[model samples]
Target: MTKRSKAFNIKKGDTVKVIAGKDKGAEGKVISVLIDDQRVIVEGVNRVKKHEKVVNQGGGNTGGIVTTEAPIHVSNVMLVDGEGVTRVGFRREEATKTRADGSTYTVQRSVRVSRKTGKDI
Candidate 1:
């Protein structure tokens, strides 16, 4: 049997803070998300040195001991809100809309909300 992983609420472009690991307390904007590995690469967090070979393709590409952000486990980070790090929650809301014939209908939408303040994120 196999288990499915839950979708991550943290997405690219969101500000997050590291809650655990060597980079604990570090805060940065989320640069990318690795859903399959359940890891997130936050800007300026979990940096590591990489050795690369210089390529003679187009413009000269210099490569040697380059420092870059490394992927951190998603669970070690928390989304940052107005009041600081807080857990994320989902809220479903109904919206009423009218069509060209003046007919009304309802649609449901889900939004990410802050658990601490219960406000939309």
Candidate 2:
């Protein structure tokens, strides 16, 4: 059997804010996560320009400079919650229990709370 890999609480569609680098304070939704590289591509962070050459296609076409966001290390991003502040790890109230046909499934929740106010975040 293949061993399961460590679970990263962050998901692809999560909102995050850049805490470091040239794009500091920029916020965007997560596009993709690279677990192996520990990187994430935000909607508008670490933008880099790419020069493209026009390829001859029978029809009219053009190629020029395109700006795209490059993946930044996950450590550089902080998950932003409803309050729009950086999150600090905290314990959840309890595991959600689901029962179907007498089978129970307990889903563990990871809560991110405010580091400053000590409230749910």
Candidate 3:
């Protein structure tokens, strides 16, 4: 079996605010998560420019100076919950699951919680 990536409190499509670095105070939707590196790419945040060389003159993968969002350390961002940013907390709750053979079982699953509101985020 393929190795599994570590779970993170932040996930793709989550709104996050940059807490440090050049993009501090900026809030944007999460574009992707880098589990191993503990970094995340937030839309329109931590943008960097890269110059590319044209691979072909036929309009395939046109090369030029491109500005794109760079991955920032996960610690530099805070998940946006409700009206403001809040620290992420995890709690376990019982959930029912169906077995492959048709048996039902209860399992505890970790849920993301908002530190500020004490509600599921």
- The prediction achieving the highest lDDT against the true structure is 1
TM-score of every model versus the real structure: 0.87, 0.64, 0.87
Tens-digit lDDT track of model 1 for 46-108: 999999899888967697889999999999999999858999999999999999999999999
Per model, state how many residue pairs clash. 0, 0, 0
TM-score result, candidate 1: 0.87
lDDT (C-alpha) at residue 108 in model 1:
97
CA lDDT, every model vs. true structure: 0.94, 0.79, 0.92
lDDT tens string, model 2, 1-121?
Answer: 6545555656799888889999999999999998877789999889999887887888644779989989998888988876675556576666757587677666768675667567764
After best superposition, candidate 2 residue 96: deviation in angstroms?
9.7
* Backbone clash total, candidate 3: 0
Candidate 3 lDDT over residue span 7-59, tens digit each = 78899999999999998999999999999888999999999999988788666
After TM-score superposition, what is the CA distance of residue 33 in candidate 3 from its true location, in Å?
A: 1.0
Off by over 4 Å in 1: 1-3, 96-104
**In terms of lDDT, which candidate is stronger, 2 or 3?**
3
Error of 3 at 85 (Å): 0.7
Question: Where does the lowest 10-residue lDDT sum fall in candidate 3?
Answer: 1-10
